[model samples]
Target: MSTPDAVPVSLAEIARIAGVGRAAVSNWRRRHDSFPIRIGGTDVSPQFSLAEVEQWLRDNGKLTDVGGREFLWPRFEALGSRDESGLAVAEAARRMRSPRTRSSHPGLSDRARDLAIEAAQLGRREGPRETFEFLLQRWLETHVRQLSTTPAQLASLMTRIALAVRLGASEGGLTVLDPACGTGHLPAAAAQEYDGEDLAVLACERDPALAALASARLGFVAEDRELRTEVATADALRADPFAGVRADIALCNPPFNERDWGYEELATDQRWAHGLPPRTEPELAWVQHLVSRLRPGGAAVVVLPPAVASRKAGRRIRGSLLRTGTLRAVVALPPGSAQPHSVSLQLWVLRAAPDNPAAASPGQDALFVDATRFARPGVREPGPDWDALGSFVLSAVETLDRPDSDPPEGTVRVPLLDLLDDEVDVTPGRYTAASAEPSGVELAASWGDLGTLLADLAGHAQHLSKLGFDAGTLQTTATVGDLVKAGALTLRAGQQPAESATPPREGAVPLLTVPDLLMDGKPSGLLCADSAHAVAQEGDVVVAGVVRAYKAWVHEGPPMALGPQLYALRVDPEKLDAHFLAGCLRAPANGRQAGTHASSSSRVDIRRLQVLRLPLDKQAAYAETFRRLRDFETLLTRTDSLGKRLVSDVSDRLAAGGLTV
Candidate 1:
């Protein structure tokens, strides 16, 4: 069963095992590189090791119904009594130990992670739809974090979207559409809750790769033959994939921040009834597009950029839509719900109720939520958190159902009059008054006082500056190698996993990753705990050898440690200003030296770091700047902490039936 690639078995063997032709296997092989590669014997014949082929097949979509034991045992029996399959499995297990393999196939560690995510959806019974939804979610989730969403925020959004489908939307005959379906998670989520003979859904995506992926996921859903759903690959705006067709609901999360939408060409088109959307405002165009595809009274919940709520050009279109009464509720999302970026988002729930008065609720009385402060700590992407947003939206929608009447249980109601009185500001903060202040202002003040009382260690910064001296001349600046020669700093190599003595604790402290340093430099509060061991201590000057990055932080607490892969420069304070040492590390000449000293494998030599040349006083001044910046950041954190505690307290009370949002 072994092939040239390793433990027997080849791509041909896998094609034979799956009863598919070689072309099919080759196509999959070409598309996904992780498809097992054979050991180095080149051949005209497409080859694969049985172990690698089986692993790839299992990972992609082949052995789902079969439990792991069943999947492995049969292959073992089919092979030989000598248990070659066992050896292959063992080899694959060993491959898992490799960092490359681990990074490539993170899914292997916990195949059930998707299932666990689905378990969060309460009212929905687990079924094939749920399984497919979870699978598609995991697949789409792979790139959304990179495309825009943060990993943590993406997880929360997927969970909330799943719960929304399970709780609020009827699954019996649901049909979903996303006009600007990026990677198609919405339709995929719909396919999970309502993919049977009765339910059908379609997703329209413009990006070819995303459209293909959406097609694959939705086709995979309907591929079972019993399901009745499909994802269409096309521009939802220009060409309505579901044109001349009606949907039960048109759920979308369209692209925001787009300046131009092809409006001039579609001016005479029938979708824009309320008003013509300004060229600068594309959101209204999407709004019209979503409404046009929905059946009368059919609900469409779309996520929009904050500008759509109150931007000048957005106002007229928004007003017309409100006057027409299709606009339902506008739920303000916490910032940073999307990652690598932070812009406030709002959920616009519209229905094709051309005659419904609620849509035309007097004078722009849309339900506004001030969810800006509603976020939980820990890996909150770049903006406001929207982890619990769906629940809030669901609650608001339920309240809206009893329009003009008081809400029951967990709902807050504000008249549109009140909203207008607030100058048509759609931010939820415009409606809701500030909640109780921090419970421990006295403690905060005391801490502030303590910060003030801490004796200011006298430094030569003021004196040197007053004398018109260029502070960059303290040390006859040497390269990092020279510093190493002086024994002022050293590089500690990142240990291989096999060489690691300390196993990673689930949540001890963050182990900084290459990505954690994204966005120009390291984000102030980011830390990763994925690794077992880390290096760097208080007052350590560190540089990421792999990332070619540098950062200097005075670890205020012992918890502020860095990855071992990073080089820590322990400078003699009397000899060099640690801040200045960091600045030298950033110097172009020092960078060249460090690059020269870096290992062939890309690891930087710590000894080379100390060779850089820097003036002493300049180092001190830089250190002073770092200190002030850190202190200011600490104060900002305190202010945020107070806000977070306020929201948390309110959510707790609401959950306990003592308060409402």
Candidate 2:
């Protein structure tokens, strides 16, 4: 068995542990003679003893409290498969439950006991809630192939709809149910809706380990509220734990298209009040189960695959649900809503139906909202616009309750009788028109802006074509380190800002980050008034300290605070020009020399960067040329953005009959 100190760490791991860039780590190795010697790997990427690096950090006041779970996670993952890690997390939660208890859980193997002890120590340092959440989140990430979690956006939206219709019940305020609560995100969302009210959560999960985690998650998130949690480990369909307890509000995101959902043995299950769900329609079974658990006047939200709305095997059940007004709205969510991101999923919001058949509303209409239209265009990452999509679906549901209100675009309310045909298809996209034609005024304005952008781009291209470069004018160069020693320039490294500081209100200073520097340093972040970090001046040159991603430019925007992986070079006006120095650093030869290793993505050493030695009058000529190049680059980006938008706009207008040819 290898001890925790015997573990090896790479240079990249050391930087992550210290919460700084690799350049800072390299600087430490050069300055401190007591640094750990390389014990493994090649010269380009060396490995060192974990224990030695940790001691050096403590002696130099760089490390505090084992770096909070970073040290333990590697050892924990080394335990074995994901199930082993999950058991360790469960045992850690048990240890948290009893502060004085240190005994190993009978479920964990002898190999995992050491990891559980390390996790307990972490729990003591950081609060148990935070440490436990971090461990559980990592565990889920590692096991994404076997499990899936509902997005917080979907959870909150479903919870809010339940809250709107939930009536006062059972002196205990409201009872919320999650029939398939994976990690308790849905139930937690419901718990957060009402803090002062007496609450009770009834959750069920097939996996015992996950059931324990869901219970602990709720315990942490519930805080000081009067909350009672009844989480059962058995499958909800096989054995109903809270069958007699009808809930006032409920939300669930169930596993879709499962074949072995007890269709044969439980052929006459009483929960299937609508009809017996077919072998291939497990999502429909979950829907009926959740709906059955609701009180006479209660409501529940369930997420299902799009096929359930129109599957040939489930058409009878779909029609029965529509005829009784049990399924009120079918909302088509955009891709990336759940595991199978290639296909769009549907959210079925179910309301309690009457017991007698005659009491069902005969003339009621069902709302079909096409939220697939809310997917934003030109986004590289796959995910719906949660804020806009959620608002659209929730508002469409709100419109259903008020018959006088007009339905919004991408939404339609059809008569339930029209949907009671032989097919009984309730797909939202089939009934609702997703895209609407744009007005003539909007189309005209877009065309005019596109023409202006194209003209400006052409002008910039012509200006850049006339400038000629002479390679014979090269001069002797001095390293940035040598220039600093001679009092010609000053170099300052940026610090990592707290992530809690997001974009602030008006009057706050913008923070110049590495990404911002790459895109001309236009301040993509913010630093509040109380912050005391150093700010870059107008004439200072900022450079990104990363190889293969080199970017350098003179600061021309408002005075801004510096972010990590960035360096500011403040030059002496008598000796150097900011634009000239930036252009020198931007050269490919200088970038190759500044990089510390052979790898293309190595961190840069600013001291190794070189600048040309020229007279003040001679430098002014080069500075003017560099300034023009910067303008051409900025104009090129603007032109590319406008060109893409015009292409999309023109195609859309042509399809909608707003444009001819």
Candidate 3:
């Protein structure tokens, strides 16, 4: 609800933003009287003014790339209240709007003039549109914690779906609406997706600052791009802006679970045609309001919490929407699609006009696609594979009543009569193949895999017994750095690979990210084969060079582009065994020795890791032992996965009823 820069920043945060160390900031504070004064907090942990520090950094040339994230946008945010900041951005846009268009300019504040100057300089460097984006991107990153923003991925998904439906029925250009267009991500998505089309974007936001940002960003970015953008500074639901105009495609990712979304006052608002939403059911209200703005045959894609699908309070509204066939597909998105990353969000794809539901939708059965399984597992905040997830969802939509007749996986359709039960639970997980029992053949194969895993696991246990031997004389250990210098190994720190497209490009190479290295799965990301980065080859030692947990692997898979937060060690086979080095690196002692941070999230300095000195034959002996242990862990993981699947399949079958022996 508040801006990220609202609170004075600590020295640590200053250093972080400046991409420097705390020591550097401390030195600056001690040496330079020009350094920003401590605005708040104690001497040991003093906080400085964001605006002053940024200005000091620039004046002293401590900062470069003014448009970069190192310095955030519209310094006026740090000068006064959020509204004041909004006014400054608006004033700057107003001044700039004239010069480019030959329109008259207005008198601006000193701060607004500064902002206008910064934007103009950047605009001269990288065009006007790019300057707007650069400014916005930095602002977004700076306020990531403060804003419950509609993520680019979610915005893209919503616009793509809504626009797809609208395109089928509309001609020429289409009008897009985002009633709660926070930071204009939805409108941005629409503009970017259909840049050549004669697009009209209508946006409204509660916060004047956000509204100004939306207007300025749209104006500059959409310049010369045939975009007609209108951003209003008012609560669209409360003010009902553009209520008379029906949008062909409406996309909204409204504020969720708000107790005071005008519930007490807007009780009689005409948008509630389906039914009056309960006080606790604001998502339903958002859906109905967004739906009300849609023209005949128009489509709306709304992002909502999972509870909206089955909440008892909204049952009446849900039932009405279903009955009228206004509600179409209720897609269950993977977690991390939006702000509350932990909650698997839902997308309510709706048709505007209830009078004209798609007639060909057999039995008028509502389609449900459970795409939650596409979330990248083992990630701290797992995001779905958008390309695969979106494509699967879209494909499933195309196959309305034909349940599970194809491959991208989760899909099921339930007759409206079946769905209109006592509970009226329209959760995709409840009806899709995700919750369905696996067939007899699938179960048989699972059982077979589990059996094989167990057999291999049991057979490997004996090798561990022979690993124990009499204690030998104390031997010296060499650091990984020493080994690298001795020509026995080649250690290359990983770099961030380019973001892989969904399904990837034809020639994009497999990129092993830290997540991929930890999960021991095929690389989920991609990199250009021509990119400048080390390719992890088979038999190389791959270490997840991350904070906290210790994880290392022998790269047994095909060559892959090594991504950031990973260390790839290519050892001379005759000098050092790959498996042995990986196993030794996995040791807690090595991780502790290499760790820089004392906190739970500790960094691993691979150069400081120590490995034992041994002959080639002796190294082979240890390598074999380590290899066996790695195999055991792999088998354990696969077996556990199979065991869980078997249990889930069996339970699902029983829960569905009529379980046979």
Candidate 4:
């Protein structure tokens, strides 16, 4: 046992190091008798000795030197047990980050020193702060199953909302605090997004390792931007680390459903200025703690489970929070927006009641935004539409700042008196009213529009059905590859652009994403201009490469950027009709053929897509029929959309007392 200097690595990391697919790594582990033995981890995902794995790769000519981070990752993992790896990495970061104080800090193992030196060198090469951030992110990703790190997008959204609330105050500079800071994501996001140069961040975590990592990360960000940050390791609820330290803004994604959050121990703690939180409702305790830590007129945004809004156990505290005008806004987020991906969470923005002559009112209304439908579509992992979601939040906050301004749709200003009655249910949906129903005249107009759409759909269907096709006369078929080889068409796959690349700020173009194709051949992704992106020109046939349901579309509008997991087929007008090719690619038989290589997601080889090798004139005839069918589909879809809108409008009007039926 050569001291196990190499860190244990997951199969995914091994695949990356060997430049192979995860399937290839599984095959090697199963088939090769001489493969590295599993040293740790569960049987399902065993971790192997990094040194042995590297040696085996080298012996088999599969190894290539990528960088120090790859080599150093395992060593950091080997420093201690899995629980201690975070602290070890944090120690190494602290040492590498400050060269002058490196010798002063004692007790670092010889192995830790060596790893620190390597990290320092890598940092120097790739901008020390950035390198360390990347390493920290990778480490967090490796332990994501065990860690409760906030998702980057959610962190950004929370920080933005907190910033917006803070801007309403008279504070010139901000001191942002996250008492339950898991990995310092909120603090770092705050430092990055806050426009002020005079800023300070304070974060506390119960886990020592996590606290150390957060401290190191925030310290680095602060140093880079000449800001101030402090991180402490302690249970925020039990121990008041930052006692008497009132921050201008506090942002936290507190741990939810924490049963033993020092309830009995901190019963008399002064932080519970509101009614003491019931033990069953620890999120409420966190809310009160955050409010206690805020200066008068300061704001705090905390992520809590949806239960807190209406849970009977915390009704007293909820009412108190509302009556005091401390609870400012509640915004509901869609599922999979953050950790514990199964549940939909809510962002509760709290502000300390201002101590002013005009602020003596006991029951102030709070802004409630129901943004549950703002999630971007995906196969299983739906992401947030960051721009739209953030904009909605900011707009809601702006509406709150103005006393008489009406909140936007999916949002409302619920009176505290109404909220405190009976259920005291502060759920945004409970307060948000649907759009007012249309008038009788408007309903008649909608009906007329629906009838017109139906007529158009019927006409298009009739035209499509009238086209004659002889199925008995078969034509020779060829793969898309064959057609490309003969220069009949060109096939190109879109490459995902760099994450840091900025999109065009103006005249943003729609991005045709795979999810958009799977939904209904619509462009649902953010509209942005990226010069480096691949564009699908008009008349080109676009097809989804990775999918559960096959989708293909013929480009009919101005050129738009093609997203990843999609292929664009440019047809030669003299050789093939674009619509005909699109229809052929979208056929059920072609879908089955493309699904051959697909498992969970389709990995269709676009070149292998088979199409009929008909003559140009015949292809044109088929394309004309396909075009009419496409029009019929368009009309039917539009009609369905209009019908839904009409029904919703009618229902809303009826509910709002604007309509009779």
lDDT of each: 0.53, 0.78, 0.75, 0.77
- Candidate 4 CA-lDDT value: 0.77
- Is candidate 1 or 4 superior in lDDT? 4
Model 4: residue 660 alpha-carbon error in angstroms? 5.0
* TM-score versus the correct structure, for each prediction: 0.49, 0.72, 0.80, 0.81
Write one digit per residue (lDDT tens) for candidate 4, span 145-212.
Answer: 88877877788888887766753445557788999898789998888888776787888998776887
Candidate order by decreasing lDDT: 2, 4, 3, 1
Query: Tens-digit lDDT track for model 3 on 377-482?
Result: 6543457778888787778765643544552467777779988988788888888765456788988898888888888888997767666666887888999999
Better of 2 and 4 by TM-score: 4
Checking candidate 2 for backbone clashes, the offending pairs are none
Q: Residue by residue across 1-661, what tens digits does model 1's lDDT show?
A: 3443254545554554554545567778779868776553356664455566677777788654432222232233333322232222222322322213322123222322222222223102333334334333433443354353223344334324323322234446666666666555676566565434566666676665455445545555555545565556576767776788776677777776666567777788788887788888788888888888876666677777776676776676666665555775666666666532466666676767634444333434455555656543324135443435655555656555545665422234555455443234455544453332223565466456545433221123333334454678665546566666677656454332211213445564534544456442332232334544355677777676652554434333454445345555676776777665665565545445556444434544445554335455656666665555455555556656665655675555556563334
lDDT of 1: 0.53
Task: Say which candidate scores most in TM-score.
Answer: 4
What are the RMSD figures for all models against the true structure? 14.8, 6.1, 5.7, 5.2
